[model samples]
Target: MTGTLITVAPTGAESSKAAVPALPVTIDELVATAKECEALGAAIVHVHIRDDAAEPTLDQGRLRETVAALRQSTDLIVQLSSGGAVTDPEADRLAVLDARPEMASCTMGTVNFGDGVFLNRWEFIVDLHTRMQDKGIVPEYEIFDLGQLTTLQRLLAQHGLPYGGHVHVDLVMGVPGGMPGTAAALVACHQAIRDLPAGSTFSATGIGRSTIPVILASLATGGHLRVGMEDTVTYAKGRPVESNMQLVARAVGFAQLAQRPPLTTAEARELLGMVAR
Candidate 1:
């Protein structure tokens, strides 16, 4: 099996300091956590900025602060959330691509937020993807459900690179009203992503308790993974995880047991076709 790239999403919009107190939120905390995750075998750190009281926001100033702190300590690839809080509509969501940290996640299509619908029209999607391409930043495609898969296909077709050098894809599963967590669900997501062009790579991430289930299934099926308190607070069934690095270490151990070695930061960069700085 090809080595896996373990990306640790230290803090996300939905997960809380209360749910997982060790979750990284502030600039200092996030940088520290990203460094620790890197130490624990994660090649990439997926970040979502939160406010002083732990509320998620993609506010430009806060994102700048968080990323600056991250660079001071490590060169680990930082992927930001353009899908912040799902409730924050289209106008409120965007990647501050000005910093251009090698990679960022771009949601293919919007789905329902808890009480309302999340919105990302073709204009926003195309504009962001175009911006990432122009900036040479790899945009990790996020698909919350099957319909979003088609949306990604449409974008891929529109881009049509000379050698299919499209941005990477991340199959995000287990959101409410989105795809359920099942082995079959994992298979379906794999098939959808594999249907894309030859060069693009994909990763699997599941919300809440389904995180490890999907990770392992993805591993068994030859796919990369993302994990941490941001996705699931538990270390195992009924057990609480203490930190993001703990989850990363557990994933590394599981991958070893499955005979799937993890991709180093350099190897991960190669897999995603990123240029070295």
Candidate 2:
């Protein structure tokens, strides 16, 4: 917690460009978003690519191109999403590593995602972890509930440490079926994280209305922050988010106010064990 590590998840698999026109669905848009967010304060970009139709897709080619373009454009650590639309097949999801990103998201377990179930069976989780370790790709474990942290511990105990030897997690709260996005819940999650490996770091994301509350709670507890249009569309009660840059600027402002200004990309790379010491 030396400095706040702000991550920008510009676009997620669940959001639609039609619904949120500003969602970065194309490679050009994503690269632009990455550059702007990196300049604003974000050290990492948690990415989920879409097809020509602007729909969620785990296509390997598109994934590779996206990774390449982001790297060429910005210093932000590109993290691909392995939990592609709940409907993505395991093979395709696993194949995301073929893109060879610096980091990728590995959801610890499955949960009821709104109307559909975001399935992450034990075997699938193990496969994703082992593959990332093999490829030297660091993983940011996505924890939707408190119990998933326990599962993360078990995974480490059984399969050994992930590649890069650092354990980082993201608390995705306030989803319809996951943990609530409240200061109390964030504190509980923060406490539960102590059971994880020593020095493990985490970032909290509050979907929809819980966004600001979760951000404040995370900063107070010395945790990190992740923000973007992917988690929220409305910036306020009646005001819609203009773009991802607006969100990144807001996060930067918050970190500055907390006296924990955002970390640089190089610092973030070291923090995540991405660079060789």
Candidate 3:
């Protein structure tokens, strides 16, 4: 098996300009940065797009353009996010993957986003899994907490869903209401994944300060690590990150020190079992 499969989430749906200066806002910028990350050592580029009106709309046409641009520009594995700034309507979330990127985000459970709710109703999740399968796009199951992994297993058992042999999971941590990304918490989440239905591949990512501890723990366990301005903005203490690629470069060194070699884009895709674009 290859080492850590670093998925560079250049821009999260809710990642703001205030948090990271070089956050990709335009399609051209996002595609350019994704290619840069691939060159720096990223296998998968997870994307979130905006509508024609500049709002975070799930316009399929815009998404197609983003995917096409990235494909034309780089050999990196492209992964679109089903997560939206507003995830109430599942159709809206699935619209981006209607263009059929190699992989799409499969957020597994509901979460409390500040004062509001980020609900992933049962019906939509099941239906979206089928949609992703119909388009031949593999899913990277996203878990905000341990319980959501259960949702993923249930959907897999019920529908033989997602239609892909390996389901890639992004174990998210330190999202306030979600699992705290401490070393022990990170280990606990990885343990929970071991009990998931057979044939599932998993990786861990931490938000804010928890990124350091969670990433270190993941490395110790032979699990892959995900880092970007989307997960964190600072490197250590109060220092700021120059770019998403900078964070990725730092992770590459960390992987080596942890006795694991960093994966190239091709190796990362193979390790994650994603379809190469």
Best by TM-score: 2
Every model's TM-score:
0.92, 0.98, 0.92
C-alpha RMSD values across all candidates: 2.1, 1.1, 2.1
lDDT of 1: 0.78
User: lDDT at 222 for candidate 2?
Assistant: 90
Tens digit of lDDT per residue, candidate 3, span 164-237?
57777888888867888877877777777887666566778889898878778888877887888767777778
lDDT of each: 0.78, 0.93, 0.78
RMSD (CA, Å), candidate 2 to true, equals 1.1
Give the Å shift of residue 93 in candidate 3: 0.6
Q: Which scores better on TM-score, 2 or 3?
A: 2
Quote model 2's TM-score.
Answer: 0.98
Model 3 local distance difference test score: 0.78
What TM-score would candidate 1 get against the native? 0.92
